[model samples]
Target: MATRLQSKWFRDNSRLQHCLVSDPHHVLRGATGEHVSLIQGALSILDGSRIADDEQKRHLYGPTTENAVLEYKKRRRIINLLYQTQADAIVGKMTIRRLDEEMKAQERSRSHLMFAVGVSLPEPRMVILSETANRDFVGWANQMVKLYSGKVVKVDAATDPAEEVKRIRQAVNTAGAGGLLILSVGHGVCIPQFGEQGTFDLAPNAAMRVLGKNYNENEPKDFVSPYYDDKPAANTGLKPLSQKDKDERDQTPGAQRRLKNWALWQEVCKIFVDGKLSAVVLLTCRIGGAPLFLQKIAGQWRTKMIAYKDQVGCYQTASGRFRTILGKDKDKTAPPPPPHTNTPWGEITIPLSMTDMVVIDPPAAPKTP
Candidate 1:
């Protein structure tokens, strides 16, 4: 039920004659009549000569006629360097005005639409854990940012979960509205409860440990410091933990630090669900049961969500191995395969305009995590 403009009525009314095109003087309509000939003549004049054949011009304003008008508009736009003109496939006054303008002048002047290409427009933003800022992840994030002309914000692994959420909220606010927010998390763990939606934690395993001389005997030996290797020293002796110490360590405030996925979603909704963002891409592992929460929230805010279904590989392959796989003498100028082939990963997209979610099952293999 799109609104249609009655160009014939406007042409008949003297009051609306000012809005009609003077050059070629035609009232274009979507029906079969003599007005179609006038439209064809106007299109032909705009093209600098006759474009449509006589037989085609005499026909109704069907798909072929519409396509011809569109082709003429496209060619004129290219030749005249016009950017702001709408390509509505209709011969209107604005189209006539654009055709009358000097091509040289169009080239010399920048359209107001062209001036706002990258500036003052919303750009994608990313937040990643410092612990997971490996070479592969950082390179991939940089590539995505460049691809979308976006911005990136890094979250420190050492920051408390609450403070981390605050930092992320601040980053989303800084990113502004009408853009995508990519949250790349690492070492996520899912905690499940019976008859309840599970919660996903984004705390890296390396952060759940005691550091330096402040080692707790109750803490698990499985915890390793990311900064240094565990080597036996004369002053510091590694000892087995007692049952009491283990219980105490489990109950410790720091030991229980984990980012709840639901809580993270709530925080993100508070900051970004202002009906401004286009979408949120959650690039994390084991995003189980979170899509439901996201869908409910997205429905309320009229935003979209893109979530991964399983673990995404973020580590880079060795240089030697990579070269072997791609062949050392491969042609650099050759085009890569199409993106829709050999699907492996899965993604779910919840569009703002639709009630049902769209699931891209086994989508093209991810180029980067």
Candidate 2:
């Protein structure tokens, strides 16, 4: 049923061409004679290749040809299976120019891609930071990409946080998605920056742009503050980093200059305001209850930012210790495991609060014309 042009596309890609000709019955009637010659050519190519003996050669090539034939029988449901299979070969070729333009024109105007700069610890060492955590985060992130139209890239555990943030911002800007998401986790410190007039609290502002007026402004002046009450609304018990911890943190490789948790959190807020992000989620302690100056944005109070002070340990430790806890249950049948689970570390769901931001949008509406 393929048109002449479509059949030609399949023939151009060697692997897909081989697959198409593997089964005589599935190929177009017009290509039958060519298909026979193709088979002869393949046999000739194999004749000179590295095959120890007739028996081994026959065993390998025989099943490969047979499997291809069987698989093609079911591939006919595809509207343009040949074209889809050959898309890569013809990507830069003239054949797809019109189709490619039309496809780009139809894409959503909003950007779906987001980027996050995550830190496991202040110094990138001490405490418990592992490759296992990065792998786990990447796996969950890929699932999120599948749910959404755009991709999500993470920069974490970088040797240089400032440079890493710069690269991430550039990539996301190039992607031009509707919104962005940024998450940073590590030790939160409060420190003073020496200035012309007086000392100012230094916030996290390396390689950050778009949260305030111009791109690359480091001051944390424009933002909103959430009022922390005695009652536990989101249950994140946030507290300021003590002076002792701040001094110790300053000695860390990346923390030579003292940085406050509030300042670091504000960079996330800028993403939403700069039209680069629809939502931003911070997975650190004391982010929600930051001081008034740090929290005020555009002369209004902004409180949606959720911060769980000292809760990262809870999530990681809970899942890490799941094996022990489940064993203690002593019940015979275990419940179903969480998605993409580490056998030892049960399934992970971003805390209920952050799940809303992670959900993917549904596919488009059918053509109504």
Candidate 3:
């Protein structure tokens, strides 16, 4: 396992270094059996570029060279040695200096260190009410954030929710790191905005009603522009549009705009809609907790935890799964009797690496009708 991990790490680092500074000729001659074809293709491309110094090119890609020779031998394929000898004879010394320069030009693009900040939920009521749940979130988040010098702001848990959200949003926008990691862990529910449920329909006039011709963020007082530009005289109770039309209107700019409510789902949704997040890990038990903001960019990667019971606490099968939860108590005491209440409980899950295990209570599931 250690050997495999080390090799994987080396390969990953090599790939990273390649992205940072790649030699075009080194790239041109990559495989063992494909040497002839690769060389022909490279020469065709290089010939067009007017690359001078044939000897340098030979050393760069020719079969007699160390890299090409090794690559050829690795494939267990031996071909015309006369062609190799002929190329070696005509080629001069002195490796190409321009390819090295080109490689150096791409150095800045190969950064691996990443920084991210994640928030479970920005609402105060939900976090404070669920203390154990909050601990789980804090423990898991702090562990992950330590890798990147990042911070996790518990909005509802904090003294001032508004101030915390503001600070968090600012940090997220200015992190200036490789990628921003954002998590919105909480319950999710859809609301009827203009009587539409998950409707994607939008019209030009409805769009204008929601977003306006020239929307300005500078106008703090005029935060939400009125749905209607002009109201009819006196007894005119004529609605602006049908519920379906109004739904379309609400869906337009409101879909992109900052949410009006401070719901847990909305807080998580705000992070994605704000448009600074690179990767988001939703810890909510249910799907569709947060909209897919960076979905296509990251594809299908996710942080999933599966729990199983052991002697004391539950254990996760994946490596380093329960490490965060298995912490040493300052004063370890004898285990207390299990709760007497008829609580449908689950065991505490810890990683397999740890020696000690402890029991913990999970948040009670809501009773179904």
Clashes of each: 0, 17, 4
Clashing pairs for predicted structure model 3, backbone only: 55-92, 124-156, 314-348, 322-351
The weakest ten consecutive residues by lDDT in model 1 span 341-350
Best by TM-score: 1
The most accurate candidate by lDDT is 1
Q: How well does candidate 2 score on lDDT at residue 77? A: 27
lDDT for each residue of candidate 2 in 1-369, tens digit (9 for 90 to 100): 222223211233243344433443332212323232233222222222222222121223333333332333223222345555422211112322222222223222212121111111111111111112444444444443443323344443332345433443443343333333335433222122311111111123322211211211123442112221112234456755543345454565333232433344345334334433333344333323332223333222121222322223222333232111121112212332222111221122233222112222222335798
Candidates sorted on lDDT, descending:
1, 2, 3
List RMSD in Å for every model shown: 19.1, 20.3, 20.9
Question: What residue runs in model 3 are displaced by over 4 Å at the alpha carbon?
Answer: 1-4, 7-133, 148-161, 189-237, 241-281, 287-320, 323-369
lDDT of 3: 0.26
TM-score of 3: 0.28
Tens-digit lDDT string for candidate 3 (1-369) = 011112111122232234223433233342222222223222322232222233232324343333433432334333336455322211111112222232223212221111011112221111111112444444544443442232333222222334444444554444322233333223222222211111110111111111221223233222222211323354556765422244345655543332331132234335434543333322222122112211211221221111112111222223333222222221112222111110001111112211121112222334799
* Candidate with the larger lDDT of 1 and 3: 1
Error of 1 at 214 (Å): 34
TM-score for candidate 1, residues paired by index: 0.35
Judging by TM-score, tell me the better candidate of 2 and 3.
2
lDDT of 1 by residue, 80-158 (tens): 2354544557655655334334321321242111111211232334443334445555555543334223244454443
